[model samples]
Target: MGAATFNRRSFLKGALMAGAGVASGAMLSGCAPQSASDAAGSGSDGAAPMTADAYEKLTWSFEVPPEPVDESQITQTIADDFIVIGSGVSGLVAAASILGHGGSCTLFSAGTKAVSRGGSNHAVGTKTQKRLGLDYTPDTVAAHFNNEIARQGYRMDSRKWWKWINQSGEAMDWITDIMDKAGYTTTLELPFKDPNGTFSIPGGAHNFYGPEIQNSANDGEPLLTATLEQYILDNGGSITYNTKAEYLIRENDNTGRVSAVVATNADGDYVKYEGAKGIIMATGDFSGNPDMMAKYCSAFADYVADGAGDYDAEFQFGGLMPGDGQKMGLWVGAAWQNTTPSAPMIGWYGFPAPCSDQNHPGILLNVEGERFINEDTSSVYAGYAVSGQTEKKVFAVWDSDFAYRFDTWEALGNNMDNLGITPVTADEKAAEFEAGVEEKTYVKGETIDEVLQALAEQGGIDVEAAKATIIRYNDDVAAGNDTQYHKCKEYLIPIEKGPFYGQYNQLGPAQFLCVLGGLRTSPDCEVLDEANKPIEGLYNVGSMMGDTFGTFYNFRVPGQNLGMTCITFPYVLGKQLTGN
Candidate 1:
């Protein structure tokens, strides 16, 4: 129930005592009745000796099938130097690192392929940043990161944070080299700036653009993963799909050292995989587990509860990842960290066009047609504010000048190929909006009053209330100030232009991009046990890892949660394993 307190000194003490007991041919501490057989190895499976009752008492959300799975009934499929569970970004990177270092590895995934999950990966001092003339040092970013963590009510071990911050650029380089070999182009997602010259967040949003840079859905992630997957296979590494890790096998009498992993394949046949080096847990967040959400993340629990009347299908931002890895870690006496629910990177749905553009000053109204938050904030703040609102839905009302007011990703900067966004002019955007209206995808009209009526008809917004709200907003704009929300005066543009547009940014309950934190891991990504000691051969990465973050997800550094940690740490972990 409390945090584990074991450190290096205590762990060394325990190890010395166990070694002394073995040398003296005496009973080990806590092992009852002191038998010679027990002295040799406590349990039948040679694991940390535990009573049946003790094993049953392990706190976890999922049912742990009795451990020491009958090896005779099951099969020993493959043995390697390393075993990686979950084929997401972390697992693939780890496996690749091992194989690249001339080590043998076997990777298992519940899914068929590595997912193209996060929007961007964060890295400081990246080659892309240099080429794009965006100068951000690691120390500066780390300071911002530390401030963000403290501001959010979660404390981070600065040492561990520094480990990630320092190695992030190198991690990006490692991945980019792989992408380059695979003929995939990596691009940077630019940052936003306010009218008064304050930038949104330091930009490190690296995206894979493949051979072509287009607005299509395939934003280079498929190519990236495909390359990594192929490299792992071509390097004579074993990758098992549709295989679920069941339990971790500990070394001779549960010595706080993991030796092998037991898993079950799709055919219900069990397979035991022993890794000489380590076992890495990459199975992503437990957002799909309702009980886990209720126990650990109250914000998500409340959001799910609030959405009962609206819809039944819970929206999972990055597919269904049921926290298989977290459950496994918990069963093994691993301490949890970052258990607080960070705000989800909520997306505004139902409208094909993008809302929350900083340059495009718009009115954001809640279900009651009342302005809730300053729409002039960064996209992250806007999304977070909307996610916490009643019904998690809001309206973005703008005039025909919307696109013209917000054109170009120049603030963010160009990509690797010297490509900058060609601005979609207001007329072009207006035409597209009209087309969406005709296709019944949006509501638009020639006048503000007509748009308000259409919005009420289409999205059940309070028609009269919306009109009054817009009138008040326009009057505030005319007065050269926003008294209600105090948005930037520069963004206090009136919404009285003809061809007014109103679209519902209706979102469901907080759909998390990925839940971060599970088994508490050290800087090296080693999974820590009950005593704050690293489980000898067990490591954690990606969202399955903990300690890199505090309470809230830092929207201040847009993609750092994924970029700096999820993508970077695993690569660093891999190199650390290889002693590189």
Candidate 2:
């Protein structure tokens, strides 16, 4: 139904079968052919390759950088001390900081307005936490950061991790001040406590929501972005809407300073925007580009043929960014991150359970009606587990007494640790489940047999196998030791008590979220070349920032993608440029 599973097997097979898969020549159906001359290498108006000899073949994008727009094609030009591309969270913040600090900048957005689809900014030792009395010092976070690194096979992309740890407080405080002036409350998400240490993620997810926040057309990050946009304007910063950045104008080809960016304007004329100080490539991910996805992510290329997300769909759910900045960076001698096959910041969870993250600590069954995971892992891990199964989907089975078994359910969904949060009680949860039954998102039956029937009728699960699984699960609960996945003993609640419920999940738009990474970025937010040198006058932020993540976006740091790439890095860069 989607990008051929995109696991290693399919990626390799597709590459071999397609014989460069839209790289040097014609692609499979729905793909247009390009010449081998498109293969990128060090040349006039081209990227310097990481490899010495690189002309055998390449993917569609790497096949060749589009010819640099001829200077004669340009009809208009704009110059500023600094230029920030792609007006998302990163661009907006970077531009605002520059102008707010009395530096001149021009911000550009391909979209009509600023783009932000996510809320929550993870920070360490921020004013919010200090005021809330939440402990988030280096000592408190060291163990968790170490665990995160261990999970990534001990590969920390750079010391930027430490930078984020040390300076996130001031960066977040900067935004909090803007938010405070707007009369909106910046609330911290109630942290999910893992007594048995299900990859402890304590505190530091700042979200915006309140009466004044609701008054904005866009709440959460949109509100924040809108606020930043206003700040930039108020501080005399300029922004150009409906402008699409095309390529970098490097001096002396790939070996010189990146002096300017050429873009297409609303009236279909070439426009050159140059920055005296620097040009920030904040243009985000390449999820919307099939060739780029197949080439880099090694997934979802064929989805283009299947009529999935297009460029216009970039900011919407199940949509993808075209990775404009990344492509331009590559064309200008920038390197991809060391972590091979860049990971997508996806949310594969089938559903979000109350008082818990998605793919709740309950019985999860593959299509064959067999249990798969420990059922007690974090949401992202649980999502990865679910993705590896048949059809890359599963069904969640639980019972009515599920809430009472645990003293406190995971507050991730409920945001239990929020300062203004009213804890969702066991009775309230049960009542909500009743409401869920009527809504049809959840199916409940008075008895186990009845529930199994409902599961089969609604979800098409094998009823007998489901019953056997439930019985076996109950037996494990009674024994006080899980013989299968070794789920926490205390969390091994039995399924005997009714009414039983089943939440069916099949991979859909909600299952796959945005992809992360493209250009290899330095800790200073500068886009780096293959030779490990920073490309002069070139910087990256937001989804364009790479090398700091591996495998997946584990919420171990909660909204780290935003906190680091989009917020802290750009924010810090802004001050650095202004000598603040």
Candidate 3:
């Protein structure tokens, strides 16, 4: 009675009834429902009372339904040598590699085409590790990963980390080869200067090539996924888009391996595709799964709302990551790894426009109009800028000089124009400044005092306290050292410039792609269960595997994420699968 442990007899009673496929109505009618307080009292007092009706309900039996197979009507579909689930970058690469090596495969996913256009791919800059001419050996890559893991306090599985590192280099080479063979040219070179002054391998790295170059021109995820899809078809692999893997069917005893995948298409008709050899899970992370995100990756809890869809006229949040693999794996006694270190989301550091430019230079400030972290540290710094602020909102305070620098920055020219941000001279920006102006969408404030007042009026901060905070910042800048905030020397420029600008960088929930952390797999890409045992016939590639980013989201090395996908895991998994 202590923990209400279910003995074999009790478990079997319920299991046998459930297995018989009893109707819910019949089962409910036979049971006596108790009040919530009564149930709680039973548990607290260490006694579970089963009424006569409840016992009878537990003893009821129902006939099992027949399998939905009609010999005459059912078409016999031959099993493939391998079946890959989730046709994202990793799935496509695995499928293509398998087919290229004389193995046949069928790729399945929920979306019509893989939604590679998600966060990482959409905003990725075009850069390649090889072009940077950095001295990045495979060992250095491994060390970087080790350092990352150590930094994260070993919260992730070290074994999986080693596996990914061991195979990353070859994976990069293989992806590059595939792109080249497909007529895409690998041309982009690494752009940023490594603050560490040492070359680090790019993440999810790739260079575009040929006729598909323009469409797949940028370092976008969609283009990369599309290219990989084309390669699969070109190499004799079959792809079934708009298909979802509902569950995995194991052997009769659930011991041998994954035998077949039960999938449904757009019409909801189910098909059991047997995989005689292997099954690979390449679905992206569980950021879309609100429960999973909340449980495993809580740092981005505020962003979960953005990931949810409008359900029944109410807004919900969480990863739409069906978590097909996670659910199926659990049912089959498989283990999951890297439940921590979720893929980091990029934070935007800009404020409302005409005072802000999403694509270029902008300054970030906390709710009290204080700059917390280095704004230029990483592309994700914007998202991290407002993290843990008291008011949960930040301010992007900039003037004409900031706007001019943003417009003139070469890397931002194309992006700014695309976003309809025309170049504005310093004088033009100053002339446009408004004092304590609160429009529906944009909040503009001229003087530091006016800005704080507007922010207070708008419910973003306390007006009096915010003014005092700003005055202190101005004093620090005047003294040539930001003793209070420790801001960069360059940014210490006093906000004394007339037409001083400020806008609310709302810290409300928002969704962006980039949820890290997932199933743990070995160097050969074999996914292991929660017990650290291999899930036979199951492998993982892409974001599904963890430890790609060791510790913090280190922007010191660009393209490491893409490099891992485009260059590392695909080939590693391929070699292990094909024994090449």
Candidate 4:
């Protein structure tokens, strides 16, 4: 029993993430506590004693459940009230919650130290939101929720989304209470206004700050997982690092509770850890497993970036997502979600565009200088549109007058329409475009012709078509009408002025960041079987849980998965399990 090798014996898992940034949270590999190392990691001798398999007909492995290691291979048994199969955001939070409630938790992770990717943690009504003066009413949030699901074809279950909606604020507040005392700060991510004005949400999702939070300009290490990990270890909860949970041990076959878990330690020793109360699967996405990728997200399998091939042996942490938990769950009567063709957290980074990568309201073209897409969509849709283009590339064209076309500019996670957010000034937007020029990503031109030539130098564009396209665009703009895609007339700023600017950006299916949804989990975080009954003592949080989202993961809600799946469900699970 080691790393949930569901990638091999690791069978089908189906969690699909929506946001584009993914934390390749492969914990420190081969690192364990002193006691574990001394006791062959995770305890001293004995396999878990539980009932037989109830679902004998259920296929156990995609390859092999590795023929459960010999009983003698289990050198020890570690008994605890709760055993968590990962040390990521969900696992750490679950353990910390249990510990906070005065319960014992034994956590096992396949990597070193606790880790997470990205920072935005979206929550609705919370103390932090109140503190930020952006308190959104439940009705407003409900309206927003309805809009979101409608866009996803309403495939999402109201129960799942409501769990997050009603409880996510409390969830964020719970973690915020911890972080507040830990000398941390919070803020709003610059919000990108959807160009179509079709949707909007509160932008002040919790953004953790402080000296301990290592935040770079692009991605942030919120130190959340580390914080939760520390809390668990300090509060007397047990954790064995570098141990990968092999598979689950159920009682009465699959009819009874999940009694225990057997994992393989760094030293390659199998240790049976029994959770008297329950066992939790906090493993992340299956983006790292090729077989799972092919099975769950077959359409985008080839575009899952490059690190997947060496996911287990040479994990590219923060990039690779091995689907051991979901796969492992499948072997134990747990069923994958009913959502066919899962959604991925993908984005198109618009560097030279001098605007939100998500919301683009300008003319866009391909390398061949052909106008593509309506260009009046949110960044996520724009990214999706570009992903299907030739060589997965797009060029954004605008003039120096771009700043004046709109009253405000789209920023990172901050919402200007919101009370607490700082509005982007015209000067700031102009300065950004200038900065792009200095970087050479945005070319400056005295005339449209010069701008087109400069753009050609950056990435070859069909100037003839591009020139003709611009003429038609200007004509349409003058008529205040879009003849092609019929984009929003308000944003159709004619690209006629001198000192025009253009951005050459590349985006393909390769921009996959996270894959959302997996197991059929209840609102309480319990994993359910194909029969729709809760698999007793078996629970899941984070990307391991399914039916939480609908379509393309967007920063629209910022950290939806982290806030809902990773934080909210674990809060409910730990409290319900321990009555804390």
Q: TM-score winner among the candidates?
A: 2
**Model 3: lDDT of residue 303:** 60
Better of 1 and 3 by lDDT: 1
Between candidates 2 and 3, the one scoring higher on TM-score is: 2
Decoy 2 TM-score against native: 0.88
Write one digit per residue (lDDT tens) for candidate 1, span 491-543.
77778777877777655443444456667778788888767888889998887
Query: By the TM-score metric, which is better: model 1 or model 3?
Result: 1
lDDT (Cα, tens digit) per residue for candidate 4, span 1-580: 1232223211222111112111121112222112212222221232111112311222222423445678788998999889888767888888888888878889988876676766667777888667657656466678777777787777655588777788777777889888767766555565444446763445646676555323321233345666777788889988878787888888886578899988888899899999888999888888766556666775555565554523232223222576888877877878888786677777555743334445556788898888887776657777777777787877778888887776666544343324233447787788888997898768888888888887788788888889999999999999999999898876787888778888787764346676788888888888999999998888898886888776657656667777888888888788889986
Candidate 3: tens digits of C-alpha lDDT, residues 287-359: 5554455435646644654434221111122334535565566566565565454655453534433222121
In candidate 2, which residue pairs clash?
A: 38-63, 38-64, 39-63, 190-417
Q: How much is the lDDT of residue 333 in candidate 3?
A: 58
- Model 3 scores a TM of 0.73
Candidate of highest lDDT? 2
In model 1, the runs with Cα more than 4 Å from the true position are 1-68, 139-147, 154-158, 196-199, 212-218, 252-255, 302-319, 348-360, 407-423, 509-511
Q: Report clashes for each candidate as comma-separated counts.
A: 10, 4, 40, 42
Candidate 1 residue 498 C-alpha distance from true site, Å:
1.9
* lDDT: worst 10-residue window of model 1: 305-314
